[model samples]
Target: MNLSVVIPAYRSERWVGRAIRSALAEGVADRNVIVVEDGVLDGTAQVVQATGARLTSLQRNGGAPHARNLGLAQVDTDYVMFLDADDYVENGLLAGLVGALERERADVAIGPWVYDGDGRERGMLRQPPALDNAERIFHWVMHAFFPPCCIAWRADAIRAIGGWDERLRKDQDGELVIRALIRDLKVAVSEQGNGVYWQHDSPHRVTKAQIKDVMYAADVVFAQLEGWVRSRIANGSAGDERVSLGRFCCKTAWVAYAYGDSAAGAKWSAKARELGFHNRGYNYRSALLASVLGIRISSRIKASTRLVYRRIAQR
Candidate 1:
């Protein structure tokens, strides 16, 4: 099968070369490596040219969603994978994902990934066995287990889904996966750890430091999922819909709290509770704090705690 690897790059001069080299080393003559340079002032363009990859340069920075969409427009391959410029994949990533897709007759296949951050390897990001359907895949995605680099999509399937949402600056990967699952697309999971997600303390990484933007993105995703759940219930496919929505609310609440958005945390947690989701562990703590201290005060507490933790880590 022909595969196209698209790398969305923005100010990624430090790692773009490595990313391009890794994609080239996949050893598929039919494979195409397209790098979308999202208005980089750095030497990212030079690096892409050096590697002889097809380069699409945007006049201004438009985020990963826009860059990926631009890259998708140029794709003529049977399968496509979006690899971030700062990330790399194992040698057999494309072959393994394509093999799984063919064997399982799946429209999309996901492999395991490793997290490399702070000059060290964090660990492997592995999914549970046999996530073979829409509901299970949505559940895993809501919990943030799915990353874009580890996923390969049938070109036709992605085109049918209308590609990525260019409006979202964060959580676009999750949004795309949610859309796929809502369409009841077949998903296959592979055990091979072939994707590497490089996380560094770079201020240029927009998503890493934008807590408010993250919360807004979460709101967008939850709204989309809510609409999908309603449609599913209307169509009599309401299996685990309530539970899944509640779980998603709970997860989003904790993330909001962690990100110093106590108001959103409280709102989502209250919704989860209204849906019969019980408080448990750290979630209970977040819900209680949001309820008792109110949004402004609870947010202050969270921010202060985060500052203290960062200071301690710096020492």
Candidate 2:
């Protein structure tokens, strides 16, 4: 199967070469491994050139989604994959994902990924539940995440959905894939392959920033999801997605609290209550704690605990 892997590099001269090498090691032809340098002259293009991979340099920095869309425009292969410049794939992972798409006749195939940080292995990311398409999408909207490197897409199917949303600097992959799935794109799970997602403690990294800004970014994504769920409910096409959404809101409230956003935490928790999702054990425990400590104090406690854990992990 013809496949193209697009690696977007932005000020990643130190790591882009390794990413390129990993893609090449996947048995993909050097010519088919394209690197789009996202308007950074930080020797990233030079690194790409050194690997003999096709390099497309942008004149201005336009974030990852824009770079990915530009890369998508150049794809002439039947299937395409996106690899962040800091992350890499295991050997044969690309081929395996493509094979899954072909064998399952799917528009998209997602695989598992392992976390690598500070030159040590962390753990495998949790995979989404095994469910039919509709149920799976609901679960995905609720919580699960598949990083961009673990996903391969039928080129045409991605193009049909207008590529990635360039407006989003983070959560672009999740937003794009969820949008595609909501459009009824056939998706398959590739259980045999996995990729490496490098975790960084640096706040400058986009992934780290995603966590810091989770309240805002998550609300944006969840708004879209909630609208879709409401529409489905109105049309009598939804099952228990309403309850799932309420549970999702409750979960997000915890995240907000952990991130030190008490106002947002209370907002989402209230939304969950509005949706009649207060009977769960965790919810009951959280409510008891909040009643005793107040939301702001509760958020401070959660944030402090997270900070301590992060420092310990960093050590």
Candidate 3:
């Protein structure tokens, strides 16, 4: 099967070249590796030209989601994967994922992945198991714990969902997955190959965005999900959409706390409680701790402990 890789690059001259090479090294034709330069016009385009990969440039600076949608519009292959300019695929990874999609007749195929940050391998990350049931799929999409590189999509399936949500500056991948699963798209897992998500402390990293802006973008995403889920319920869908949204709020509270925005964290924690989501262990822990020491103090303690744990894990 013919597969294409669409990499969205924005001021990523330092890493785009290597990302393109990794995709090309997957035995894909150089022309099949498309990089959409997101209007930065930095050395990123020149690097793409040097690698002899197909290059598409936006006239204005759009975020990765826009760049990815533009790149997707140009793909004519049977399958395509949207890879971040800073991340790359393992040899044969793309082909293996495509094979799984074909074998299982699935709309999307997700593969295993590992963390590569600070020039060190952080071991294999957890892979989602079979998404054979709607409940499992909903939970996975809601969490959106995996990066985009771990997934390959049938071009039409993504188009069916109207591509990525350009309104989001972060968590677009997870939001897209939520849309896809809600539409009842078939998903499968590929255990044969893996991708590497390049993590770093770069200020340009989307994850490093200002906390308030991040919260706004996240609110947009969850609001979109809420509208879709409410519609699903009106149509007699099986899942309790509020429960999923509650969990999402709980997770977003964690993000708020991670960035030292205890106010936003408290807001999200309250939203979760308002949704009647007191049973989950995640919500229970945060609510119990916040009620005692207050959100500010409790969040600081949790964030500090998580930072130490993450540092230890990276070692």
Candidate 3, which ten residues in sequence have the lowest lDDT sum? 136-145
Write the residue-wise lDDT of candidate 2 on 140-194 in tens digits. 7554677887889999999998898877766777778778867889988877657
Instruction: Tell me the TM-score of each prediction against the true structure.
Output: 0.85, 0.88, 0.87
Cα deviation of 33, candidate 1, in Å:
0.3
Best by lDDT: 3
Clashes of each: 0, 0, 0
lDDT of 3 by residue, 120-143 (tens): 566756576875545654566454
Model 1 residue 221 CA deviation in Å: 1.4
TM-score of model number 3: 0.87
Q: After superposition, how far is residue 204 of candidate 2 from its true place, in Å?
A: 2.8
Candidate lDDT values, in order: 0.77, 0.78, 0.80
User: Which pairs clash inside model 2?
Assistant: none
Global local distance difference test of model 2? 0.78
Distance from true location, Cα of 246 in model 2, Å: 1.8
lDDT of 2 at 22: 86
The segments of candidate 3 whose C-alpha lies over 4 angstroms from its true place after superposition are 141-144, 227-241, 257-263, 279-292, 308-315
